[model samples]
Target: MLCGKGLVAGYLGAPVLHEVSIDVRRGEVFCLLGANGAGKSTTAKCLAGALGLRGGRVTIDDVDVTAAGAHERVRRGVSLVPEARHLFGRSTVRDNIMLGGWTKSRSHRPASFERVLEMFPQLKRLLKSRARDLSGGEQQMVAIGRALMADPRYLILDEPSLGLAPIYVDAILRQAAELARQRVGILLIEQNVGKALSIGHRAAVVETGRVVLSGTAEEVAANPLVVDSYLGGAA
Candidate 1:
């Protein structure tokens, strides 16, 4: 299990997150849903160690990693695919995928690349294609592939479905489910209430940096407060 208990963080000493807590179990899809600026990304940053927490505890498989930096955390099997999908615009798909293994030993790259190819065969032919030329969906796949190359135990995805067409959106969500089934704990942040409800095993709704609602997917979807606030929103 990966967890954050009473996490608090922000920039310039101004807090954006206030005592937020979450739990992600291996092989389970634990989702965080909220509107823009709800501190969803902030929480991810704190958990993934992209930023430091003012006060909290972050543990992976019962090991305390609250003191670990981002690179150290990555080495410890945590990976983050931020919302931007920050691929090298001019690099080939293969080069981009290889970059994610920078934290690992050179000797491990080949096996990691093979594993990624197995999961996302679509990248096989696009290895030489420049990242910028690929469609949005393809770029997202490359980003995910790059993360997989690291063989992370915990994957944190921020707004993956944003700006994607329905087909691509469906594909990304399905892949997330597949990763969870492979025993990777997934902390998915999204604005798409309907989609998260459909695939999430457990869910939380963050309001003003706090978890205002959390429960099994069915329970959250049926909450009047959740429906009134987040229903009918597009990814």
Candidate 2:
């Protein structure tokens, strides 16, 4: 559903990603695994149109979006849940989620909000509560729920489990897997190899801004190099 071809991008003047490429097929969870600063987030930003690419191209369902702005990408069904769960601290949970559907018409928002509430029942219960009062895990749910509010066909998630407890992390990963089963293509950027591998349909390992490995989850999980590099030789 989404494809990045030979993407080269960076900040300031120095390049962090070089010729990195990956694809997320329809109904699949494609996880991008790497150490800190391996350019996973940069790749996500490029795909979401949050960062402009210095080279290569990004496409969604065959439409080139390399130069499209973030909001334009959203209108084309690309939604990103960034690394930091950027929720409005002063806004109520409902209000925060509502902002995600700002791209949709007013008549369409109620149905979208209902869908989000169904996907995240916890958020439904805290609709009137302030975002700042929620726990980290709850806030993460809000972030995901907020993205779902946009009704995206392809969801780009960067570090969804970054700071949560094990239970919440597991919950979020399972929810991500469920989303894949529902045919929502996901580009999941994660530093947590084990959890990402466990839930991902396929995995790509990025090293120094390049995709060094790519394959099905089982194939990657059992790879000796992947085991040595990221899985601690457990595979």
Candidate 3:
């Protein structure tokens, strides 16, 4: 449902992504695996319209969104949950989630908020709580719930497992898998190689700003380069 072809993007004059390309199919979990500075986030930024393409194309369900800005892309059913989990620290959890649907009419916000709560029952109990007081796991849930309030067709998750305990990471990965089963196209950027591969339908191994390898989960798991580089020979 999403594709980036020969994408080149970066901050200022230094290019971080060099001709990277990948595709995410509907109802599938597509994993982008790479070390820090491998341009995984850069590729995601370009695909989600958070960064402009210096020389390439980004298409959503075959529609050219290469020139579209972030808000326009979100309107077209693309939403991003960045690595930083940028929640409003001073705001209530409910308010933070509601802000995600700001692009929608007032009539639709309540329903969207309820939908997010359904996906994350814990948030329902903490609606009035300040975002800064939540645990890492809860904060991550708020971040994801906020994006879901936008009602996106394709969800881009960047390192959702970052800085979390093993159980929390497992829970988040499981939730991500469930989202895929619900027909949401997920472009997952995960540092937890084993867990990501176990849930992902397909996986791409990136190195030096390029997609060095890509295939079905099993195929990628068997690749020596992938196992050595990312999986620590556990394949």
Candidate 4:
């Protein structure tokens, strides 16, 4: 399991996450739902080691990793697909995906590349294409493929479907579900509350930098707070 206990983090001394705690068990999709400025992305960064925690304990399988740097954490089987699917516009899709294998041995890359292609066959055809030329959905696929190159045990996806077509959104969320089936713990932060809960085994709602509600996806979907606020009162 990937767990963050009593997390406290922020930018420039202003705390954005206040004692926020979460757990992502292997083979399950753990959704984090919240409005803009609710600190969902901040929590992802902290868990993925891209941002430092002011106070907290991050553990994977009961091993402490709170002080580890981003690279170190990646080496320890953690990966992040940041919001907006940050891809190298000028770089080839192949190069962009290969970048994630920096932590692995050179010989391991070919097999990893093949595995990613198997997960996203369309990318195989776009390997030589520059990232900037792909549609929004394709760019997002590359972002996820890049992260998969690391063979992460825990993957954090932040707003992965934010600006995609509905079909692409379904594709992205389906991939998340597939990853969970492969026993990869998934920490998913998304704005599409209903769709997210549909695939999530468990979920939490964050408000004003704190976790306001959490439970089985069904229970969360049934909560009046979630229904009225995020699901338009019909969840």
| Top of the candidates by lDDT | 4
lDDT per residue as tens, model 4, 40-152? 99999998888999998899888899999889889888899999778999999999999989988999999999999998898888999999999889999999999999999
Tens-place lDDT digits, model 2, residues 117-200: 787787778999999999999999999988998888999999999889998888888889998888899988877788898888
Report the lDDT tens digits of candidate 1 across residue range 107-188: 9999999988888888899999999999898899999999888899999999888888888888889999999999998888
Per-residue C-alpha lDDT of model 3 across residues 1-235, encoded as one tens digit per residue:
7989999888887788889989998789999998888999888889889999888899999999998999999998889999898999999998888889977999998898887888888788899999999999999999999998888889999999899988889888998899899899999999888889999999998888888899998898889988888888865
Q: Can you give the TM-score per candidate against the true fold?
A: 0.95, 0.97, 0.97, 0.98
The number of clashing residue pairs in each candidate reads 0, 0, 0, 0
Q: Which stretches of candidate 3 lie over 4 Å from their true place?
A: none
- For each candidate, what is the lDDT? 0.90, 0.90, 0.90, 0.93
Q: Count clashing residue pairs in model 3.
A: 0
Clashes of 4: 0
Error of 2 at 133 (Å): 1.1
Q: Per TM-score, what order, best first?
A: 4, 2, 3, 1
- The deviation in Å at residue 70 for candidate 4 is 0.6
Model 2 ranges with Cα > 4 A deviation: none
Clashes of 1: 0
Worst ten in a row by lDDT for model 3: 226-235
Give the RMSD in angstroms, all C-alphas superposed, for model 1. Answer: 2.0
